[model samples]
Target: MKAVGTSESHADAVAICLTQADYKGHLCEGLYQLKTYVDEVEYGGCDKDAVPTILKESPVCAWVDGNNGLGVIVANFSMNLAIQKAKKCGIGWVVAKRSNNYGIAGMYSLKALDAGFLGLSFSNATPLVAPSRALEGALGANPISVAAPATNEDYFLLDMSTATVAHGKVEILGRKKLPVPTEWANPVTGALTPLGGSDPSSNYKGFGLAMFVEILCGILGDSGYGPYVRRYGDVHQAANIGHCFIAVNPNYFAPGFEERLSDLMNYIRNMQPADPERPVIVPGDFERQHMSTVDHQGGICYAKDLVKICQMLADRLNVTHLSPLI
Candidate 1:
């Protein structure tokens, strides 16, 4: 990112965020988005050196202006402030406007979890999803993530897009010339419900979740919402993307929260599987498995195409191409 003119701190922030995405196996949000972010900075949609500033604040909340900065930096700053506020007041909510896309919503939520608080994060994104029954796109693939700690450093992390899938995943399938699954952004049925079926009967639930995120991040953050958000990959002007981060201390509500959460998760994990070969898993289990694999391998093993993409980016920036370690 620094090679593409991002400031050192901002570059670090973006790199760290993407690295987490890769570790968690959300490749679309990880190294895959690096070139796009470079385009955003270079083409004038985002300011490389801009700093996020708090616009208003109370003991338990804050409003921030991202100053058209990189989303990773803006999100980090806002969530950090929220964590600090939560430390004193038992809860904190911070919202920011004029930020670019953050890598993944779970990254911010986990920050609070690491700080011994439950975290929920949301962000309004480029408009690509149509609301239920709409002919054209009217809503962003607004994402929501919640992370709660359990015993022995375990956690319950729920991170998902309000849309059937985020646009990046669509682009990924398109690039590979692979057929996208029906529930993975099927235009025929439109958006799928969060319940995992393409059945239109429950589709409104997905639309409602999208609206929930838009209301908090876009409206509350004082950023663009609905059609007001810029189209994806449009570098024509600044994007008024919005994000919201929340941290809440469980001690304020109940005692032994982590223990209770652990018990619940363990019980769920031990339940009988519908298919004997595939066991039911909890929210963060998939990500945890991915992380474990990455750890065992000592690093992420990029696809051949991904490495080629990185080489192209390196050449574009007049930087040395990264070589495989093994």
Candidate 2:
């Protein structure tokens, strides 16, 4: 199939690769993810040669088989399919099995916003989260994202993992030589705390949400569930990850959806802050602000070490090294 968004330009690939590299470094996950993708492509784990197929379809629902293809490409195709179905039936829900990691979940949700529809994206990942009372990791971070368009090209986007904190955050702490918060994880055992930490009352809520995502993405999609899924960077086996995408057109349900959403978001932003210096902000504000800064700078900035890693990746892949734009 054709490239996901626009032209199949080498520039697009370079930008994405560099952006992911920057994200890996900033997120403090090191270059393992970039290496994983490169190794997957080289080993045929992410079968760029294979094509995604629709296993079943209806006016408002569909099931897709990613054939262990690249997650970004497969996810884009799935969301586009949902958008088309929503345009015709007022709503669309699509699920895919045998997929790989699809990077950021918000990217898929924003795709629906771009089409003037509210969108939700969910995916099951390698197990990293333990149940409230459990010590072993039984659930993945299991991220969920939703995006709704508002007036003035604004959007309400919430993308978060069901866990108390993503595994990457722990890695970040480790990289900085900082002590992990007791509520975040058990440093000795390496078991992650749920969204509400070890508290029985709230931790269960996070565990529940994680299970909810697993139900939709894994069980519903007929893919591996919980620990059944392979380790993320294991190239010997297919990831067999699952994803779910949904799109809803506001026109089908209510009028003035965008206006009302914008009004509420603005109200929230204008709310009295307990700390006046740090104003109350709604979800997606930080990301939007960061994007603005990056746009002004013309490109993403990365640490010197990350640049070196990217240069090494370029050498390994025989691609041009990324040059500093700033």
Top lDDT prediction, candidate number: 1
Tens digits of lDDT, candidate 1, 1-326: 78767878788888898888999988879988988888898889999899999999999999999999999989989999999999999999999999999989999999999999999999998877767666567788888999999999899999988887667777767779887776666556343333233546576888888899999999988899988988877985888999999999999996999999999999999999999998889999999999999899988988888889889999999998987878
TM-score of each: 0.94, 0.89
Model 1 error, position 194 (Å)? 7.7
- The whole-model lDDT of each prediction reads 0.87, 0.80
Task: Count clashes in each candidate, considering only residues at least 3 apart in sequence or on different chains.
Answer: 0, 1
User: lDDT tens string, model 2, 106-210?
Assistant: 778988999999999999988888888888888888989899999999989898888888787787577668999978886667878778898665899999999
Task: After superposing candidate 2 on the true structure, give the runs of residues whose Cα lies further than 4 Å from its correct spot.
Answer: 1-32
Which run of 10 residues does model 2 get worst, by summed lDDT?
Answer: 1-10
